[model samples]
Target: MTESRTLYGYFRSSAAYRVRIALNHKGLDYTQAPVSLVKGEQQAPDYLALNPQGLVPALSDNGVLLTQSLAICEYLDEAYPDTPRLLPAEPVARARVRAIAQAIACEIHPLNNLRVLNYLKQELGVDEEARNGWYRHWVELGFAALERTLANSAGPYCFGETVTLADVCLVPQLFNARRFSVDLTPYPRLVAVGEVLERLPAFAAAHPSRQPDAPPA
Candidate 1:
């Protein structure tokens, strides 16, 4: 039997969204403990004990704490090998998928994180328009390179037929981009891939609006 899985995450956090997708893709049963990022609940002393980084999506599996969404996804794959694998079997193929995942997770997400954007507005005195402009600039810059990369290999998903780690990461980044009103028409390949994957049962179940902590629409 699988150990009990409990995920602490915010409903709208992209990082947390990644974890939820991974878990659903693997058909894992997990409980959610919502951490309200907008309300500053992630920084509570109790939450800090689980994750010193003060980030959403800290997971506890059978009492073992894990942080960082990408790493946590890999761990789930390792721990549940019988389930659908997120990483491709070939080394080169795996590397290609990971590179795409990191392109958004590291390069795009860091600059546009809630904390970073809040700092820009609150500390640096940036106006709403300027802050949103900063968001679209980085998203467009990152997606240009990402579009070129995916155009080479994308079919129905980021890595062609298989739903790899890259697709999991891609969906959430697109979610944020749309939230910030970034133009997605420039990247048709990504939009098509997202449409295919988003319709899948796993991805559909993980949408932020479906989460327990999501605000009423």
Candidate 2:
């Protein structure tokens, strides 16, 4: 009824992955409506109407359509503030959490997303090696800075003892990095934080591999 919400997302989309982590962290109940990116299901007329940009992680909540991963997460935070808050109450600390989140979402992810990679191959005529190089280049550049940020933070989580927006963003980006064979040795702090977060039940449930639409082995 009034509380019902549904998420339209692909299993492997990191943007969707971020929202999944946020939902799990908040312990929210929702229905998943898979949008198969590899199969181009996102471009279907129904989904396109839901998101004109044809992006995954679009949420339909209380009859309102919301798009963009970070914006959706913030909406969830605002709508359900009584649950565990994703951002710190202090303005400065909240800014720090958001800065870390954007470091991945704004800087790292867009450059290596599926659409961007597709453009590199179809339009720019990039070969597989060049595409992978593009992926690694951005991941490495982002991770280098993230490693330093995590080193300065106090915790098993990104911000502090409790999970925050930064951890939600970090875990998924690290997942992508490992999938692409980015060496983790150079970023021990980031790896350590990810390991700690991975052990938590919320994060474990949000992993792409565990999603219902995840590709078969």
Candidate 3:
């Protein structure tokens, strides 16, 4: 049996959302501990001890703390090989999947995370309109490249018929982009892929709306 796991995350953090999707995709049962980033709970002394970076989606598997959503997802795939695979079996295809995932996770997400936006506002004295402009600017630039990449490779999911690591990363980023009012019309391929992925039970269950810490609308 795979060991038990606990995930410390916020309901709306896209990084946390990615981990939840990966966990559900593997049908792994995990308890979620909400570390509310909005409430500043992530900076608490106890939580900081678990992850000094104060990021959401820190995973503890069999008591070993693991940070970074992509790493945690890959770790789950390795630790529970019996489950549905997240990466392609072939090395080149796996690299393709990883590259797509990183396009959103590494290239785009970092600049738009809560901390960065907060810094632009509180520390840099940017207004709400300017902060939103910064958010949309990065999303559009990243998604423009991502759209071309997905158009070349996707067949329903990012890597073809199978749901790969790329698809896991895509859904949450799109959700966040929408939150900032990023115009998604240019990326029809991404929008189409996301539409299909959103309906899957695993993806549906992991949606921000369904999280235990999800605030009422």
TM-score of each: 0.98, 0.97, 0.97
lDDT of 1 at 205: 91
Model 3 per-residue lDDT tens digits across residues 87-122 = 989999999999999999999999998999899999
Tens digits of per-residue lDDT for model 2, 1-217:
5598899998888899899999989999888999999999988999999999988989998789999999999999999998888989899999999999999999999999999999999999999998999999999999999988888888788898888899989999999999998888999999999999999888899999899999786
Which residue pairs overlap in candidate 2's backbone? none
lDDT score for candidate 3 against the true structure: 0.94
Q: Which parts of model 1 are misplaced by more than 4 Å?
A: none
156 Cα displacement, candidate 3 (Å): 0.5
Provide the RMSD of all predictions against the true structure, rounded to 1 decimal: 1.0, 1.0, 1.1
- Writing each residue's lDDT as its tens digit, candidate 1 over 1-217 gives 5679999998889999999999999998999999999789889999999999999889999889999999999999899899999998889999999999999899999999989999999999999999999999999999999999987994689997889899999999999999989989999988989999999989989999999999899
